[model samples]
Target: MKLLFCVYLSVLFFSLFSCQNDKRVENENSLSIQREKSKLVVEYRILSNVKYLEDRNCIEKLASCKNPKAEVRFLFPKNISELGLDTAYQEDSYFIHQLGVFNKPIFNEDENYRIYVMTFDYMVSLVVFEDKRTKNRTFTITGKAKGIFWINSSYWIVGNDCHMGCSMSIERIKDPKLLKPTKEQNLDSLRKQLQRLPYEEKMKIVRQEGDELLFSANDTLYNGIGKKLSGFIPYQNSMILVFEQYKSNKYRFIQVNEDKSVEHIDSLVNGKFDTRQFSEDDMITILPKNQSLISLCQTIFKIENDTLFVYSLR
Candidate 1:
């Protein structure tokens, strides 16, 4: 097939890297970006006492430091667009950056927005900013390629850790920018078709159209809560709560009614088309073609600063 899948991943990578010789990571300099004097709170359901952060990069080495290479130059967050704020999500064919530190909360005590999505490259290539004090912006919208093993996006695709005598393959990317997913195998075939089903009424999820592979025949449809949409404003309307009135109010879409009432809903993501192409990676990909948005997306929401964080996965 692909040379018998690279000779069956070189006999499963030395029998799984010699029984997973992990040795507590923290190796260093495969890339390098460590600048987090503070930021690692974790746990946040929307807001029952909010908190969320745990980026961990270094190409999924889980940021013990190292992640983002091409030798590191413009890898990410160097003054992130000068923080003029309001770019919420940028993905010029994969230089990604979703910034929104807004009122500051890189570690908490919130005003909200501790989001900072950063993906390095996939290349259509072009960068000629001869600095007139001009920061880089360049461009590229869709040259296809962002990430999913060959690392990058959100991270971790490391796989094949069967106790190291390793020979499982699929990490090859000696550079060409990155991402060469070679057919992601739909979440590894929906984790082997969810091990023949019935894991407590189902919960598999690969659907975001990256290549279907679903399941949710009712774990009460994900009962209640779930977060990670990243850096303010991620409304797709499974029932209500939308925003985007100011800052480039591209066709309205409010809806804050409780009693104070006010419900507009104009061009919802360009005329009723919100498959949600935004991602600072709170990693959510379960729309199994919309079965009432899988129990209202487990009912979550979090729009900071202007405040509005709800939760309900139960």
Candidate 2:
């Protein structure tokens, strides 16, 4: 009788513990971080039945198949429009590299326009979009682009002018005409000035030392995160880092502010955690006031599953 009672109590405790663990996992899977005042919402949209041209399997198929072009269709999620994507979007190349890998989209201060420096085989294209609509693609420029930034109510493009003995050109494009460069100037003085910008400064400090992560903001040096620092991005006055805790086998997203305060943004288990997905390369558009949206595409070529992750923070 007593033995039976002990066994029953043990079983009940185990069930309750399991239930709690399951609930925690479910919360993490939902990708919504509920804080006291604000909520961070994450949406994962799958682009199914497609593979990149450079993918191992796709390359194998290209070698064996007679047809040079693979008839691949990218099926985006229904809610992609909300994530600032056009459902009827068309690309010149079927290569995934041309789509989203190297091109880092930048948003204007008003958040109305999203600009992309798309690289083609021959030349690079400067594409802009207003909301979910294609605003214009006529701003395409030649030569390799270093970076594009929005500074002082205009878009600044920095690129190498190999035609001019490998010198760099800093071109500015203002409103009315999105990217009609007024003039090309030497890059030495301007490069230093641009680095002093708050956004640029914050990006410089998020680095890794050996296996430990380090971030310095406003003279406060933050270190000792975990084995690997997956990625980080500057948000307002804070920098958010995705850290992989090898000992616990978990991933944590931590926000460190200029005031030396730290906040826990989110966490995920190692198995389901996405690494090398959050960085400056990902698109980030700041909404009108107090809210921002970040989008990243994750592709698994083996499974031919591509997902676009949109994270909304308020």
* Most accurate candidate by TM-score: 2
Query: Taking the tens digit of each residue's C-alpha lDDT, what string does model 1 give over 1-314?
Result: 98786565444332222222222111121113223221111122322221211221201121223433211111222222242322333222222222321111111011211111122111111111111232211111111111222112211111111111211111111222222122222332422343344523122111111221110101121111111111122222211223222223222233321121223332223111111322222121211121111112222334443333333222
Candidate 1 wrong stretches, greater than 4 Å: 1-77, 84-190, 193-195, 198-250, 254-314
Off by over 4 Å in 2: 1-184, 188-223, 232-239, 246-249, 265-268, 272-291, 299-314
* Span of ten consecutive residues with least summed lDDT in model 1: 101-110
lDDT (tens digit, per residue) of candidate 2 on 99-182: 233333333333546444443212122333233243432233322333344444444443321111122222334452433321
Name the candidate that leads on lDDT: 2
Residue-pair clashes, model 1: 26
Model 1 misses residue 183 by how many Å?
Answer: 29
Q: In candidate 2, which residue pairs clash?
A: none
Q: Candidate 2, after superposition: displacement of residue 225 in Å? A: 1.8
Per-candidate clashes come to 26, 0
